[model samples]
Structure formats: structure tokens, C-alpha cells
Target: MTSTAAPDRPATQPRAPRRRALAERLLDTPLADALAGPHTVDHYLEILRPDWAVKRVRGEILDVRHQNEDSVTLTLRPTVTWPGFQAGQHVELSVDVDGVRHRRCYSPSGSADHRTRTVELTIRVHPQGVVSRHLKAHARRGMFVGLSLPRGEEFVLPTPRPRRVVLISGGSGITPVLSMLRTLTDEGHRGEIVFLHYVRGPRELLHADDLAAIEAAHDNVTVLRVATREAGELPTGWLSGRFGPEHLRRALPEDADAAAFVCGPGALVESVREAFREGGLTTPLRYEHFAPPELPEMDPDQLGTVTFAASDQQVEGDGRPLLEQAEAAGLRPEHGCRMGICMSCKCRLQHGQVRDTLTGEIHGTPGAEIRICVAAAVGDVTVEL
Candidate 1:
């Protein structure tokens, strides 16, 4: 005999806003705590709704836009608990796929001056990207995902806006700098602004119409769109070929002091840095890398043993990242943005030393936190996992 029963309603179902507010208030009161003695209020609230939490920040997908075959834009409505983000900061977004939670860092593309709690994230789907592909294929309105508070400080607008500003980006790297541009225009900035964006072709350009509108509305702005792979005659305001020193000269006036912000691929960032160096410009060139910088080959003789102190697991270092070695040893550790950007895989170095893969710097401080994703074992090392 089989029992026939109705399944619980999906947590994605919308709840009355006032009711949720009352419940949240009640949960915060001393009476609810006394009634639920010694148990977490979140555990019970989670049974009522998936997105409800006492301290964790979560957002519901409010809209999804397919920008192209390989990219998507998701608009999210974060819970009231969310701390607002700066124009150029990033957040760690987490989603569950096949019973495993995966997290990635993404910069919001929307203006920070908007009078709303919604955030926009434009994601490029890499061929091997798990979260990006999952979002492109399955993300929809009402889906809930975990979110971290805004987390970057370097790639932001200066306190006193420069008289002249140059913003450069390539591929999907346009998101953050686009946010900066939107914020500047929204604030009615009177400074001269030059925006340069590079893509494979016009079809791959993100926010082309919006960018054109911005340029048209603001006399102080100049927008340059470059299609690196296009051939033949190009239209006005559009150029063909990859970024080079010529493009740099076109974007910036000789001897003109301008603040610069760049975000893109490693090679593109390097090229821009080199261009600045070659030009002998003293202007600050701030940049953010979309991927981890390439690491040099590690000497095999320097490899040693890596010990997970908490798990009591040891593996012979193979000149690979500690995160990879721990995973090979059948230990599951929390990690996000394996590129070392999110700091999700950070662990305390309990004993011994480890080498930073990106900078080749060695660290051996006891109780020092290190990002395991980009750290390789220097010798017999122990880390609190």
C-alpha cells in the first residue's frame, strides 16, 4: 500500500509582503527567541521560505535578459538586509547545482545612484563555466541565490572626480566601468570623459544602444567602440583592429592628466599598463583582472607534503594549488572564484609555509589566512581546513 500525499508548495511561491515583514519582526523579538530556546531561528524560518535568513544575504531573480548567445543579464532584488554596493564593487553569488553549491564573483552593471534595491549582473558564459552556463540555461524569475556584501575597493571612482577621465574595457569587462559611467552621467558630471570598449565584432558589443544614447545626451562624453576582428570600412565612432599604442594616443591627450580605470582580460590589462609605462604618464592606472594572472612553472624539487590539520589528511604536493590537492584527497572545502578574487577558499596557515602562485611570494605566518586556490605548498605545510 502506497500513501498518497501532496508535496509541500515550492518555496519560490510569492508571500504577502506585510506577512513576511511581521514574521521577521516577530523572529527578532525576545519572545520568539524564548519560545525557540537554543535553536536557530533561521532553521525554522527556512522551512517557511528558502530566502529567509537571520544574517545571510539572499536575492531573488527579478528579471533575466539574454544579451546574446554567450551572455546573460540578471536583475536581482536583494533582501532588505543587503548592504548597498558601490558602483564598481563585486559580490559573491552562490547557487545550488546538482546538490552542490557553487559561488562566483560578479560586478553589478547597474548605476549605484538608482533609487532601488535591485542589482544587475551581466555574466558571460564561458565554455567551461559551471555557474554561468547554469544561469544561462536555468535561471528564471523567483529563483533565490545567496549573495555577499559588496567586496572591492580598488576599482572605484576617486573622491574628487578628475577633470578628465578615461575608461577602458574589453569583452565582458565592460560591466564595472559601465557602472562607473552610468553613475557619472546620472550625477550630472561636467568633466570630460572618454570611454573605449573592445569586442570581437559589433554583434558582440554589450549595451551598444545605451552607450550611444549616453554619448548623444552628454556633450562631455566620447565613446569609442572597437571591433578587433571586423574588416572593411568601419562606420563613424567605430574602429577596427586590436588595441594598440595608437588607440591609447587616440583615447588620451598627450600631456593631459586623466584618471584611468581598466578592467579586462589579463593580456589587455598588461597591454594597457605597458602603454601607460611607455607613455611616461604619471596618471594613476587602476585595473582589475577578470582571471588569475598566469603563474610560472614551479620547481619540482620545491614540492613537499600538504596536511589538512582539521581533516588529518596529507598529500604529497604536486606543485598544484592547495585547493586542488585537498579536493583530490576527497575533502570538500568551501571555495568560490578559484581565481583568488573572492577569497572564499581562504584558510588559516597553522604551520609551515606556502608560496603564492601569482606573485611567487612565500608565507609562513602561523594563524595567517591564505587563499588556498592560488597558494601552493612550499614545503611540509599544515593548514586549518
Candidate 2:
């Protein structure tokens, strides 16, 4: 698992020759970003498979691109088909290494409509892992890649209009929230929506203008950002002092039975859910999570027992992967965001058990398991999520 927010490596290491410095910059005041200036389809395609027609490339590097070196915006391209997306859904990507495949999930940036031909991804990359590393290293345009059906309903649209919609997201976990935010506007959203998002630096914020534009276009829309790392960073339009239950309540309108879409770190989601519950805002708060609940790490020795539900077959492996192990045993499972964010391959445990390597907890739900992309196996576990 563990994919979100890449660490800064020493500049001494090898890096692609970038026209820009590729560093984070602050938004003292809203400033126009050059990266967002303009780019063509050909420009992005040549980023990997030089031959635009030959979109199949193995080492396509979809590096975590920001609006600028210091901007907070992150961008990516979706690798699937169309209508392209009607807003508020996810796409699963398959990362194959040495014939072993891993599923990684990402919320499409938005619908690939008649206006825009490319689907964008606004993700904070994780330094380690299969897809993240590959994307950070070789996700170039024009490279043919495997993708899954778009999935998820976290950002359900409100009918005709709503009092408002409040979006709460933390860290690089702003993907789904952004999609919903833009959806409201692009679809000629007539209702009001408030966005309370968290990012460490203003420079790292994703889609600055998009959010600003939404706020500007509609008198009903309000955009607020929080920077946890800054002390005197007084962002002009911040809603809460920090992100949490308290911040959410303060950010939304009082009488507004606003639709709420929440995304980000699992801990933040749990906390916000509990916080909102306490606040009596029980309107089924929509949430998106890319990771299983964080728990203690499990021992590798215990990660070799799993019984597939479809095949009625039991399999054991060397802490390799639940999806991989399943596939090796002739079971093809659906997956994306193999690191855990996508939630594409989540299944329920019909019987038996499983243990997560990164997060130590043995699955809690006996019937409903977890995203298979993130778990291995343990004690002849049976999976049904």
C-alpha cells in the first residue's frame, strides 16, 4: 500500500531534464501559473511513447506534475474509455511487473468530454510501491496502459440544486473531491457548494484556478484551503483553522442540508465521520478512502493463507500479494490502486481470515473483507469486498 505524497530526494540523484525547477512555491496571493498556461495533446504524448500512434509504452513515466514547481496542484491522465466519466467515479489501473499485475485506483480528473480529450488525474504520488513508482518514473502519454471500469458513488449529485455542497479533503487525497467540485460547475451546477481542503503548502495545491474559477463563477460557491505546516501563512479564503470535524462545521452554511463529500487519509475520514456524527449532520456523509484502516503491521509468515470465494480454492504464498497470489492460482480478480486508494478489488470475507502486511490488523469484517490490492493472505482466509 502506502502511496501519497512523495518525499524530496537529494538533487544529486538522476532526474528527467525538466524545463522547470520542479520545486514547491507559495501562493502569497493568487498568481497565474505557467504550467497551467497551455499544453497540447502532442506535447503530453511525446512525454513517453514518442510515437503518438504507438500509445503502448512499458516505461511511461506519468510523473506527479504540479501546476508549477511550488504549486499545490498535481495532474495525471486517465487510461480508460468514455462517456468518458459523468463525474464522481473512479477508474482502476493495472500495473503489470514481470507478468505479475497490481491494481491501482484513481478518481478520474473529470469527464473526457467533447471539449477536453484527455482525462486528468490530480494525485499526490507515493514514493514507494508499484504503480506510484512506475507513474513517477514512466507514465508518459501515448503509452498503452491497462485500465478498469470507472467505479464509486462518493460524490453523488444533488437534484437540480442543493442549499450547498461541502467538500472536505486532506493532503494529496484531494482527487475525488476535485472531480465533484468541477462536476458541479461543468454540468452548469446551479446550487451552492463550499470546499474545505487541506494541503501542507499553497504551492502543492492542485487546480488552483479551477477551484478559484468555481468560486468566482457562482456567488454560492466558496473555496477555502488550509495549510497545516504554516504558522503565519494567513490564506485569504480559509474556512477552518485546520481540517477536522470542527473545520467542516465552520465551513458550511448553518441551515444548509448540504451534500458533503469527504476524502483523504483514512484516519481523517474516520475522525470527520465521528465528528460530523456528533454534530448532528447525519445526512449520509459521502466518503472516499484509498487505504485500509491503518493498524499494526502483520508478520509475513502469517500472510500465506487465503481461500478464493469464486473458485472454492485455497492458496498460500510468500507474502507476495493477495491479487497476485490469487492470479497465480488461476483466479483473475478486479483491482486498481493496488496500493489501496482505489478500492476497486475490495471483497468480503465469507469465511476464514486475512492479514494486512502494511497495516497489521487482521480484517475485522468476517463477511466483508477489504480492497484485495492492499492485502496478502493469512490462515486460509476466505474473501467475498
Candidate 3:
């Protein structure tokens, strides 16, 4: 008694035409075409990427040097750079821990010897730090990680500012300040500059030899380190421990008015900025907000579906960040400092609006978007990924 037609075949459903890739969209959308041009396709391809999908080995770990009990220096093999970085710039290290994608932005512990393409990172291990712990415990030679080209404008020397410059850093925040000092000295870039760094003890210091060599070679460059555990007079030998607005002022040249660069954690950076302002510093002040520890307080469970888009990819992080989940899924997006301070991970927003933690602006780029790190889904959404 079976029907000859096989009991009515399921109605055939037609597959909707595939939407164009972001590169194709740029070519099709005249507005975006004019803005980004034929180069837009390349730009889209370059920016819209999954961390694992497009990430390639830039270099292998050359060697590991221990700074003290909890600090280590990793020397990387040769890397490639395009559009040479300015005197003061930074690089983003893309790493993975137990299948979870994590990115950390570390300032060069070495100099701008691009020929070698080798950079060193002085990492102080935090008990709860993700990347630091993983690298300190497991990373080894020949292990490869993705690194975004060097970036950051906040560290650049100002042309209109006074010749005298004062650099301030605390704890393990001396990385970028070290880069700036080395660049200036290595290139004979002149102007009186003094670096004031604060640390817990001398043993935890980074690049002691390099810093000393710079100070000795350059008459205009001075290095002052405040090691709290130094049981002696104020920084008599290679290091010392004293840092604050008072110390900063004392270290400056006769020209009290000079550009001041600062780096470190949020509270430290804010405190230094306030102190500098209170001192009536008219010179251009710049700062780099170091990578922050993951906030366990962020409860993605409370959120609804979050949608996001990029050039060549699309992503959804359920109620969380598309970038994070996408990274977990092995998509490598170009990002510098994931704190949303550097904006290197900016992406296109094709669908739902998002609220940015840094700016608190509701964003839906239509075909554009905001940085992925500090943004959250406001509602059900779709993105170019």
C-alpha cells in the first residue's frame, strides 16, 4: 500500500544565494569602494582573519634568560616588519593556552635592530597571569607564536615638545620606556632624557646590562632605577628604589618643561599622570596601558547572543565576544593591546549594535565595527566576523 511517489518527497528547499565576501562587498558597495579602494580587498583579507586560521610562525624562541625568581627574558628568532616602526612602538604576541587563545602586548626589551628581527621581552610572572604562567612553565625553543607587526603612537617622541624628556615606569612596566631610551641612544637622537623606573627589588630588574650600556655610551641619557630592596644609599650603583613625582622632577634636566612618557598598570599610570599634571607639565604627555589580567568578574552567561563581523570572516560568541570565541575556535584577528587602548583589532559590524567598554558608545557599523576586545553584544547580532 505504499505510494508510488515514496510517500511525498520532502519539499525541495532552494539554497539562497551566498552573500558576498567582505572583499566582494567592498567592491560592490561604492561607498566603501571609494574609501578603501581596490586596496580594500587586500585590507579586508588582512584584517578579517582568525588567529589560528591565518597565523603563521614568525620566529622560534631562541633562548630563555631568567631575571630572578619570577622573571624571564625570551629571545625570539628573526621576525619580519613592514613600514618600519617609529622610535617608540610595541608588538603584540598571540599565544594559546590549553586551547584558549590569549594575546599579550609586550614592549621590546631590546633595541630597533630590525636587521636581526630579534626582540626580547622581560616578563615578570604573576601567580594568576595566564600568558606569563604558561610561558614561564611550558614555552620552549622552536615554539612558534603569532605576532602582529609593531604598533602604537603614544610612545612617539614629539617634535614640538622640549628637548628634555622624562620617562617613568613601575614594576614590570619598564618595557616600552626601555625601547624609547634605546632607540634614542642607538640613533644618536639627542635631547636630555632620564628614565625613572620603580621595581620591587634589584634581582627582578630587566635589561640591566643593556640599560647600563646605553647610559654609559650616551652622555645625554640617564637611567635611574628604584629597587625597594636595595639596602643602601639612593641608587648609588647600577640600581636603586625610589620613584614618584618628586623623584621624576629631581631627575629632569634644567628644562623642567619636557615631554613626559609613562607606562604601567591602570592605577599607576593614572597616579603618574595626575602627579605630572599637578606639577604643571606643559610638555606633551603620553602613556601605554599595559595588558591587564583577565577579569573573572565578566560573566558571559548573563549576555544574549552577540554577533560580529570582519573582512573575510564572520563570528558569533553566543552572548560573549566574537573575537574571543572566534579565537577559541582558531581564528586569528590582528590585535595589538586587547585592552581596547590600541585599537589594532578593530573590525566591521554588519548587524547588531554593541556597547564598547572603552568609549561606552553603542556601535553598529552597518558594514563597519569597533574594536573586538572591549566590546560586548547589546543583543542578538550578526557580524562580518
Candidate 4:
């Protein structure tokens, strides 16, 4: 049989070997033994280009714009080490402030299915947030920051796609859900999407223009802008106040089988969850929290001494997280997020018991790892830090 190549098909080029192959080949040479190591090489490469590293994933800021008075959005071009992310995933971004490195978790506010090599992060600049304030005040195009691979799979869209989706977010929590909405729209999703976002006022809304455009362009998408503070200022069709059962009823049809996703403050998430439960809705309800869960009140007398096994230091616990106690005692253990979500402050429980501040459960398994950010000493405790 004879066949002719299609005119629309372009000629393909052979794929080149990846950086790992090149590194392996270089390391096999005798010159590899003469250098200090990969660390020295990485140091030299970083001197030439901030994003150039053997294994570390770094992103260079390509654009920075203030979304509003309290928020800034950054467009980043990550190094090839980045593996990309799902629509609803977040990354641990690390940046240097003064002389100390601070890390925080942030979700990308862009379409995951978009044909681009960049990601966008919309950060709300809290008055006490070190990283957020630094990025807002000092971040410039071409500056580099460290990035962890994408994390969190709980809030991603369902694989087969549901017939209807309900997205609820408040304030800065719109980031991940916005990513999901953008991805679904880019994929030409046919399902009905009801997006309800709550903000203090119009001035606090992020990506207001994009949301308006998306709602106008897509017939299947319904966008509701709710103003909690300036309720009287909202438009006729806009919503007023926070989320409640009535809002849920307004968003979802009585007989509709819809999957719900919520990302926002603890109160908003809890209210959504409670509404779902009260309404007897069986469809999936997934949520994400940016802050640490509220801990139950603890008695100061119940808190005991904490011993750092490796550091050979001890400190009297102050009814706070072990990580805070460690910091107060002049020990700098590696940590990220400081909210127990990143798992970067996990340490071994050498002895004694600790209480999970989030769940109020006590754990005493020897040698088991515990997240120091959310684990408090039940009594006298020993930890491998």
C-alpha cells in the first residue's frame, strides 16, 4: 500500500535528552570529582541566573499588578523543574524577607489547561503577613522565588465531570475556585456552574473584570457577587450578606445533583458545610482552609515542658504550638505555612504525648511523626527536632 503524508501534519523533530541525562553524563566525567559537589555547581549556576538550579524549582516574576488596595497578583514563569498543577492545587512559595526566608501556601489563579508556561498568584496583603507584604511592596519583575511542587488534591474537579457544580468562596479564597472556573470554561464545559463569591465590598473583589467577562460570555455560568459590608451598595441582582441556607437554595436546584466546592474563612466553610448537612444534600462537598483551624481553649497549667532531643534544649510550653515553643527557645527548625497544612514542620515524637490542636486528639506513639505547627504538648514532652 502506498500512502501520502497529510499536508496539515508538520514534520516532527527528535526529542532531546533531558537535563537529568546531561547531568548524569557530566557527573561520570573525572571533572566531577574535582568540584565540591552539586551544591557548589548549583550555587554557581544561581549566581548566573536566579532560576537556574540543578533540582530546585524557582519562578521568576514576569508581571506584578495590584488587584486592589489589599491584594496583588503576580505572574510567574517557573523553571522547567515545575511539573505544573491541577486547577485547584496550591504551592508553597518561599521568598527572602530581610535576611530570613518565609514560606506561605498560595493557589494559582489561572486556567490549568491553558497553553502557557506561566502561573498567576493573587495574594491578599495582610498587615502582619511577611511574605504577602514583601511581595506587594518590594516584588518586581525578574525577581526569583522558590516554589514547591503543587500540593492538595482535595478540591479538584471530579474526573468525569458532574452535570452541575457549585463554587463558593469568600474574600481571597476565590483564587483556587477561580482557577477551576477558568479551567472548566477553557475546556468548554457544558455543565451548569454557579459561582458565589463573598467580599467585604466591591473594592475587595479580586479579578472583578475577568469574572464579569466570563459570566457574560458563558451562558451556563452564573456569577453572584455578594457584599457583606456594603450590602446597600450592591446592584439589584447582586447578593447581600454572607452565605446561608437561602443562598444555597438560590444557587442549586432542588432536584439537581451538583458537586459543591468551598474555599474561604473558617466561618464561611463551616456555614456551607452545615447548610449542606441540614439540607440533606448527599452530593460531594469539598473545601479548603487557608488558615489554621481554631484550637480549643487550653489551660496554661496543663501545658508542660518541651525537650528538644537533638538540640539538647528545653522550654516551658506556653499553651501554644510546639513550633512556636521551639522558635521561642532559640531553635530554628525548618517550617512552612505554619498552619499544619504544608507538613514541612513534621518531627518525631521521641517520648510523651501531644495533642492535635485541630482535632483535639491526643497521640503518644513513639517515633511517629507529628506536625509541630499544630501539635501541642499534652504534658512534659520530648521531640526530635
Best by lDDT: 1
- lDDT (tens digit, per residue) of candidate 3 on 250-324: 666454557788877665676677766787766667886664433333346435555433434444445445567
lDDT (CA) for every model shown?
A: 0.85, 0.61, 0.66, 0.85
* Per-model TM against the reference: 0.84, 0.63, 0.62, 0.87
Better of 2 and 4 by lDDT: 4
Please write out the lDDT profile of model 1 over residues 109-131, one tens digit for every residue: 98877574688999999998899
In candidate 1, stretches whose alpha carbon ends up further than 4 angstroms from where it belongs are 1-26, 29-54, 229-236, 254-257
lDDT of 4 at 229: 88
User: Scored by Cα lDDT, where does model 2 land?
Assistant: 0.61
By TM-score, how accurate is candidate 2? 0.63
Q: Model 1 residue 70 lDDT? A: 96
Show the lowest summed lDDT stretch of 10 residues, model 4: 7-16
The list of candidate 2 runs beyond 4 A from truth reads: 1-65, 68-81, 94-103, 111-117, 239-241, 296-334, 339-351, 354-371, 374-385
- lDDT string for model 4 (1-385, tens) is 8566774354542234456568746744546545846545545666887876655688999999997778889999998778888988889999988899888889899888857589999998989888999999998999998899998877798888888988899988899999999989989999999999998888788999999999999999999899988945576677888888779887787536678899888778888888989888887999987554576777776788899999999998777889989988999898876766778898999988888876678888889999998889988999998
Report the lDDT tens digits of candidate 2 across residue range 1-385.
9854455455635554341223212211124233433743333544643433122222223444546432222233443223456556766666666677766666766543346545566544565566656655554544545555556554555555466777788866676777777777666666667788877667667777778877877786777888766656566765434556567666664645667778777777777778777788655578766554566545665655577767878766556557877878887787656666566677876765555644555664576757677676665677762
Q: What TM-score, to 2 decimals, does candidate 4 have?
A: 0.87
Backbone clash pairs for candidate 1 read: none
